[model samples]
Target: MEIVLKKGTFLVFLCVAILASAQISVKRLNDPAIVAQHKRMTFESWGDWRPYPKYFLGIQTNFAYATVWGMWAPKINRDYKDGDDIRPLKSTGEQNLRFAQLKFQEEEVKKIKAASDTIYKRSVQDLAHWTSATVDADPLWLLYYKRMLKPITEFPDNPQNFMEWRLKDQQTFETLNSTGTLKRLQEELDLIKEKYTWSRTMDMPRGKRFIMFHETLIRWRIFVQELRRYNNRTTLLLDYRSILNSHLPTALPTQWTPTSDKGIVQNVMQQYKHKY
Candidate 1:
């Protein structure tokens, strides 16, 4: 009985020792220091660029052969077979311009006039879109609000340092708004009208026709530029108003009007009547 009891005691001790050893091993495996050492060893052996695999030598040999072939192959030009078409190539720009001229002749003044009208209509549409309430609800406005608020919010905590940041924000806002994109668009429209008198007559010399077409192209491009600027200004204005409403609600007037000197903010705020 005593021998049996001794054997049982030995078996229990052995099992406890095995379990304790497994726990220690697991803890060591999970230890940050031990994991870092293993990572260092792995990087030194395989991750580093110096110690490449056995197949890398084969790749190097193949690359050398490819380089030799590329260098020598272009020198061995074969004779062209009969019936192959050979033509002189014009530049891409010249070809495109020639294509445009041909298309212009086919469509003539009607198409160009229609395109000009469409551009004007699109500018009007963009104005309506800009003044809509949807601009305020954009998810990106949250990011803009956070960015604008950071300097102002931090101002009380660190007045001197944050003052510089606040000034920078205000400068950026004013610089962006001062582009006067809408005024530029109106000026461009008047210029287009003045220059477009030639298009109506269409009895000009061949040289004048080309010149007029070039001028028309320039006017169209100017319209595009002005419209882009207008859209940028629209976004900036909306973002500025959002910042103001969040931080300084009373800065804007209660009554917004078309003739009011407040500008785009007055127009946009009209959509939110209750907010004011």
Candidate 2:
């Protein structure tokens, strides 16, 4: 019985010792200091921390300064260091000149914008008037009538040429009666006026402005010339009819010389060119 009890006691002590050793090993492995040391070793193997010494020094310096000042340091004049003094602030001559130049440019832009608005308003009014007038008394229609009265010899001789001429003539006649030159001119004028309404003069190129102005002038000239021609032909017809009626002492036949005098139409047709 004594020998069995001694063997059992020795086995129990050996089991307790093994358990304590395992617990000690686990605690040491999980210790914060040991883990930190391992991480340090891994980082050191990669590179020295000397390259970032300036950054660390700057952080430390800032911390030290903050601790010393504690929000009581001068904040407003902090930009000025010792021995610094304030002097009168005056702009240089060049700066003043530049400022004046900028002011002049701004004023000039204002003047140009005002002028452009005025011109655009006037142009739109003129275009609207012309558009309305053309609707009732289309100069192109009168011109076409005069043209059709001309002899066929005055037109193109070649078949292709004649076809092209007829096509263009038909197109012109249709367009004049439909969305005619006056309507197109009004549309163009309105488009430019709208474009420049919100935009500055400098935004619109000078060349574009000049080209539009030139085109408007040319169309205006053509309209005035055709209107004059129509007026002259109508006046001449009325005068001829009046003279014939006075000499006859009796009212002429309705078919003798209609309001659209065929003789006057034929005579005026010779003076007009085929081109619009």
Candidate 3:
């Protein structure tokens, strides 16, 4: 196929070709600097050339791929036995994010029984090394409770970190309290739902941390996108007080006035004073 290039394109192409060939020649060449130079050429051409949307998408995709890549590696390499099959250490469930606390809870009964048995056997088998009989009565149950408390105490997070990644969510939520209708609040919720579904569930420490980071970033992106969209819409409001009040009712100062193009919507709540 015929191709076209802008001026200096031939030189650029030649440099890229050399870099591409460098990987294969690295062993024969026996010099790390040569490979580094080749890499420099390739990345130099692509310097700061990232398409952000695609870059982030690539990050998310790479994260997802790396998370699940183990499912596709060569089977068992059984002859050498380096321990590839993690399904055994794992429970017989869809291998997903390990909410370790929930997992500990699920196995809590077994754990509790085991703990109790250990205590009982210890007391029966040896007095000085054993815990008290009362403590031994159901030691596992106590252990399970101790383990379960950490994650459970974090439930329904009281709106502190709920919008941690979502600046727009917080903004919109605050906005709704002032000039927004309930519908607007619902819309903000929808914005959050659109992009931030957590898909990868593997619970490896490092990999899952990356997954969580990107997942949090996805929520932030959704928030910022919606915020910009909201900013672009006219007729939303220009009364700084109104806009701010919508999102931060409790933060209101007593003497603030609403001053939009339409002037002000009088406080009908005070004037209309419906009987309870």
Candidate 4:
């Protein structure tokens, strides 16, 4: 009798479990709203969040002191919003940025602040002026930097040009809308570039140029490259991966992320480009 009773109870538990699972499946399949919510939640739940990129950003903020702000041209143009251009920033990533900016403790900021304090040291200070003077003197990087950050409308074509994607002014006259002229835009880029005149040191090599600053940028570059690959893979899976899906299709990847303390993303991307 005990054996029979045990069997009956087990059977009832199995039925209940199966029924619950079936109900979940049915609800998800039948309801479009449920599917949309599921997608939204899935979009937000990327892994690796607890510590945030606070340490990373702090390093970049300091590094920007010695680094130049410039534009990056790549597989996509910044003007349109289709194809490989604009990747959706997951909602969780947005939240992480907010949290990092807000609740950092006193000690955390103090540490990063110390590194930056080294900017006033006599050796580094002289070097800073010397370096800035040299870059400021260069019209080529200046021109490149100027036109680089400006919209792709200013560029003739993508780095790997396919005549079809070209945005010649005569062809797309209606699409042209400039809030500022090229001269004004160049001034704006130059002014923004001037803001990073000082940087913090992370053990800072005795005479190293841009030290922690350049290294941090390298790390960010790698990070962004990896994120781009992931974005591309995910995009391929979506039904709409074409340019029409974008609210503002861009041919450029404006921002950057780095990969390591030892090297910049430029170095890494070069190493990996064969595979990319």
lDDT of each: 0.48, 0.46, 0.43, 0.40
As a whole number from 0 to 100, the lDDT of residue 83 in candidate 2 is 25
lDDT of 2 by residue, 51-130 (tens): 11223643543443343332333664234322232221223334455778899999999999999999999887666434
- What lDDT score is found at residue 256 in candidate 1? 24
Q: After superposition, how far is residue 60 of candidate 2 from its true place, in Å?
A: 45
Q: Give per-residue lDDT, candidate 1, residue 71.
A: 28
**Full ranking by TM-score:** 1, 2, 3, 4
TM for every model, in the order presented, reads 0.25, 0.23, 0.18, 0.18
lDDT of 4: 0.40
Candidate 2, pairs of clashing residues: none
- Report the lDDT tens digits of candidate 3 across residue range 59-135: 54343323322223345322212433333223432233355656877799888999999999876655422323332
**Model 4: per-residue Cα lDDT over 1-276, one tens digit each:** 999999999999999999999999898687654454444444543222111222364453333222221123232322321223121445445555556666675567787777667655755656644454444444543565334333322323312221222323321211111212223333433333332223222233324534433443444345335434533433332222233235424321322222222434354456557764
TM match of model 1 to true structure: 0.25
After superposition, candidate 2 runs with Cα above 4 Å error:
1-203, 253-276
Of models 1 and 3, which has the larger lDDT? 1
Error of 3 at 177 (Å): 4.1
Candidate 3 local Cα displacement, residue 29, angstroms: 70
Cα-based lDDT at residue 212, candidate 2: 43
- Which residue runs does candidate 3 get wrong by more than 4 Å? 1-205, 231-276
Q: Can you rank all candidates by lDDT, best first?
A: 1, 2, 3, 4
- At residue 232, what lDDT does model 3 achieve? 34
Stronger candidate by lDDT (3 vs 4): 3
